[model samples]
Target: MTSSLQAALDPSAIAVIGASENPDKIGGRPLLYLSMFGFRGEVWPVNPKRDEVQGRRTVPRLSALSRAPDLAIIAVPGEAAVAALDECGEVGVKVAIMMASGFGETADPAAQAAERAMVARARARGVRMIGPNSQGLANFGTGAVPSFSSMFLEVPPQDGPVGIVSQSGAMSVVPYGLLRGRGIGVRHTHATGNDADVTVCELAAAVAADPALKLLLLYLESIPDPHHLAEAAAIARDRGLPIVALKSGRTAAGQAAAQSHTGALANEDRLVDAFLERHGIWRADDTTDLVAAAELYLKGWRPGGRRMVAISNSGATCVMAADAASAAGLDLTP
Candidate 1:
């Protein structure tokens, strides 16, 4: 992972551009989460129209900051977001979490052009962006909840051994909510919406590098960068970390939805399965399957072989277990 992207995961300071006083707004939710979760870092709120946001003093612009923040959250809309990115880049912000929309996801020619232009501008200025329509990222370990996920408020966070990375914001936190509900702790939950600059695989590589993580769950609508996914799998494999991925868009209907949702091209499903298998990553059929074995994985259970024995209080249950095991390619022996 690049140093800039790494810094974003544990930034010591954050700037909220286009910050709002209302804690419910997109621009204000980050501040709400950051405070509610106890982020022990400097926060600079940038809003030309406001003197303070959520009771914290605000700066009129990024240029007014004493020094460039480690990460900047661009919460404005349309061209204003692009301008904020340019400002962040010029001020030497290491990474940016862009929360605006109207990018390539709309599938509009002008919007696509604008997205390309925005990316070029950031690349020229060396600022890595999270999304043009992202929900944001969260690290409970450091209380760096840059995301606006309502799940955080609903589920409450605890520092645990699990990490989640996904291309869809909902996918990212849904797994988190499930894991947390199952009494498993999740440390990282990041959603790279639209994958404008940072892809899910790239972020997976970063999350996989966390030594504290025991299990990594992923939700991918596309594999725009398979190389990074492979790299992430290798890292996890070497560290004995288990990765479960729910790669969507396997059917015609799902494929169309994936394209419209994120402007993503569907990778051939068969090839995706092969690639994941070769890299030692498990493929899950759905969200439930993605985190179903999280507890077992975290417990460090390593099955010696694909052999199974069914034990149940009822004979019918045992019969069903045996049938399921057989279908899953496990040898059912006495």
Candidate 2:
């Protein structure tokens, strides 16, 4: 059965565990974002220290909630993360996000073990986990800004046709920041940190179902579930939507960094190249390359012919345009 990313991606209600009042902090940022971004759902902020967070009244703890929320954000410290998961599962919460780090990514035996335990507990309770060391997730469609990313703070979120799902938190919003800077609006931007449960591929498949999303971008350190990703690619292809992938681990250095960050084993680089092409997904090198061709794709310009001709009054403009076309893999007649 395909795992529907409904609960995690667009929850009806959210429980912010370890919620805070400070907008800069991890717990508090989501509260502020949900408020400012116009999330039309119930937000229960769990923290005993405050009566309210970002103007939303705090609920003291998850147990005191009147009803079980669809999703839980574990913004508590590493020590309190798993315990918070247990409580969320008891309340029938379907998805929980562990935004805290020091899990398997730490490479320490205890940290790895802790990550394993967290996954196991979630499995037993039938609750899906998002990350152990993640930046969190954001859905502009639902205004579910459960992420603590400072990127959204710097660059305001605008709903549009692009969907971003990445293995790295930085990779997720960096492209969003770029797109917004270029006046391109993005609908979904998600970071599947550690990939403990909800993988980038699985989440991508879910977001691909959105009728409004015209372009889907993925940033991967490892291909955890190729079969699932294949399904997502197929869906996007059927809808005439395009998927672009930025698969890291190209060199020993990037591979080592990916391993330390996500605990993901590096797949062979050439194989990854073939995999992306075989699935109709264009492979990108960096954040810039990932969103570089985005505006062109969004313009809905269907090519009439493979012929290339540049027309401009200024010779300088024609030469510059020709160089850019060649760089972007577009045919240009010299």
Candidate 3:
């Protein structure tokens, strides 16, 4: 399952369902990114209404394609998205990125049931789904960006050693933007909203297997599957790759907000902390804390212990460093 999920990250061919001619629209943005980023893959645009989308000849639907694409990006809304999935099952498309919303996050009983039904449909057809309300996934390294993030447009991508996997779309790219600002190159950024099918940790495990990665960052509202989270951490630990995670919803109000945002149930904060610690994953307090030490980790500096000696040209600066070290619980040796 992990291998199959990993394959979606670097698909040789992709079909864009609900393709649009307008570049700024959700359906068109992916086509623009794929062309702009230079994804050297077969791109089939599926839009029954259009003969062409973004200059590419369009197929009426997935069934019209000669063969199943490696991945499908479903950009339609509500029942339309489900209908697209039905087509995918018939055509044998193994993976899909669900960009449509109005699912479990809406907190409507019908919507939640719809989300569950979609997942059941996907599983029955052997299709692995990324999201039902996802922003999408982007692999800058391969130019295989199926996402419609304005962040990619606002912040130019430079492929590097870092990868980010989050349940929130904003959190996924927030670290990317921060790292890119510091001249850090990011290779993978993915979000699994609603987690109706694929959870964040499962995707992180796939990302962790990339030989080019040095660091992995995660942002989560919940952990419904700790087994995969542990698997992800094990993979990272085996590679000596640092995993920094920001698990939100420590308070009752925060938990409520998280549940509303992604249909996530909050885990006890202390247990989450212990679980991450046991797996050798660092638990960050905030977004800033998540990427603050990225550079240091990328430089291959792994401190074996907390004992440290402050060294600086200025005596005052050294004193400040010592103070900071002490505050962080690092022992300052005389």
What's the residue-level lDDT of 270 in candidate 3? 93
For 16-37, candidate 1 gives per-residue lDDT tens digits of 9988888878889999988988
Against the unseen true structure, what C-alpha lDDT does each candidate score?
0.90, 0.88, 0.91
Stretches of candidate 3 above 4 Å error?
310-331
TM-scores for every candidate against the unseen true structure: 0.95, 0.90, 0.94
Q: Quick one: ranking by lDDT, best first?
A: 3, 1, 2
> For model 3, what is the error of residue 207's alpha carbon versus the real structure, in angstroms, after optimal superposition?
0.2
Per-residue lDDT of candidate 2, residues 48-128 (tens digit): 888887777888778899998988999998778889988887888888888988888876999899888878887888888
At residue 258, candidate 1 shows an lDDT of 88
Winning candidate number (lDDT)? 3
lDDT of 1 at 62: 98
For candidate 2, the TM-score is 0.90
For 1-334, candidate 3 gives per-residue lDDT tens digits of 3655865899989999999999888899999999999899999999999898889999998988889998999999988999898778888888899999888888799999988988898889988888888999999889999998899999999999999999999999999999999999999999999899889989988999998999999999999999999999998888899999999999999999998888899899999988998999988899888989798788898788989997778999888888888877899986
